[model samples]
Target: MTTSSEPRTEPRTEPHTELLRPDGSPVRVLVVDDESSLTELLSMALRYEGWEIRTAADGAGAVAAARAFRPDAVVLDVMLPDMHGLTVLGRLRRELPDVPVLFLTVKDAVEDRIAGLTAGGDDYVTKPFSLEEVVARLRGLIRRSGAAARRSESVLAVGDLTLDEDSHEVARGGDSIHLTATEFELLRYLMRNPRRVLSKAQILDRVWSYDFGGQANVVELYISYLRRKIDAGRSPMIHTRRGAGYLIKPAEAAAA
Candidate 1:
């Protein structure tokens, strides 16, 4: 572990602890790295964003800190002495599956990345990376995930179905529904455009980032994923227009 050449200040209490808005709270983050100097540097950058920050130099400490802090998300290192990052992540998934994970490691191989994702990483950033880039990536995850942590009644309803945007919980006929991260985003977009036709290409453009593998089929996959939860019983609210694309509206919403 290396120390930063710059001066350090005593850490402050995170502002986000009091924040409970759908717009988001100041992020609570766990920085796990074997290098103390790099961890400090990253912590400094994250603090400037007014984020609540904590640091761990090894996998064991990372797990302990995470369990105690209960951060909104984590920035993990792939290498650690006490245990491998992958092992820590597996434990994290079982204990805190909803917390978004961003892996920062030197393992840049494609297979390494696939393994991380399979192990439940939400995003990955290779080491020797820019602090600004890490900050940006972390912000994006927080924006998407912060909703699920708060008690929320703010909802968007088209007909019989409802999506609590603040809570990120979906329901139909008053029963709860669980959706993956991507499925939530896709449904949010469709609900925002209720009764309007959204082409697969448009859905791909909005839901997926530019760097994602250009697989249009991902839209098809998630749409089915949504249906199993949102439309498995009763009449289907989401309809496929054989040649057109896809659209969502309540049968009553259509009449209205």
Candidate 2:
């Protein structure tokens, strides 16, 4: 489980490290936690990524800060003094439904994580997480949200697997597939490359940038994620090359 307190021996770089708001403003992030020390640590890490930070210690304060700061993203704690984290998020969603939120909590149970995500959390970092992972997850969420805001209107298609960059929507054979930010980007890279075998190192470098330390397992994990969503119960488009890399092509294309 990745948490914010995990120590890192080396620095990590994000693909959108220099990302700004659509309006050319610095990206803003609201950090909500009753723990002042934790908030400080999060703020420092986010600031290092060039994002403006707002801190809130309670549910009410979080809601007020969200209204005032209009952060591009939020790092919300599930437990609050005044209210439960989900309640606060429910309120925030009414005001800013499109804002991406990442949850922070000590609950490490599978069901607890599911509950948090089912509550509309874009992602979460459990207790004792590495700040690098937190930053990576945040970058992924913000990148996808920003892409949606920009509405680039770019579309990529490969053997019926289609992704609309502008709308942040993916579909396979008219069946909609909902994917997380990272998953979408990973698919986009695969779709762009089409049947070409892309090594784990290549995928990591291109999709996650060099900051993720070229973790091959991460690549494999996401590939399995994509396979489940886009290929299960359908003609498979993603193929593994054993010791080589992964490739995405139309099922028919592969046969041909």
Q: Best TM-score goes to which candidate?
A: 2
Q: Which stretches in model 2 have alpha-carbon errors above 4 Å?
A: 1-17, 147-256
Worst lDDT 10-window in candidate 1: 14-23
Candidate 1 TM-score versus the reference: 0.49
What are the per-residue Cα lDDT tens digits for candidate 1 across 1-256?
3223232334443222222223333347899888888888888777655456899988788888988988888999888888999999988777688999999777679999999988889899876676767776776787687532332336566556778777788888788999999899999788655556788878888888553466777788899998898988666778787766788766443233
Number of residue pairs clashing in candidate 1, backbone atoms closer than 3 angstroms, sequence gap of 3 or more or interchain: 0
TM-score of 2: 0.54
lDDT of 2 by residue, 99-179 (tens): 999998887899999998999989988876677778888878988886322323376666566688888999988899999
- C-alpha lDDT values of all predictions: 0.74, 0.80
| Least well predicted 10-residue stretch by lDDT in candidate 2 | 147-156
Q: What is the lDDT of residue 166 in candidate 2?
A: 82
Query: TM-scores of all models?
Result: 0.49, 0.54
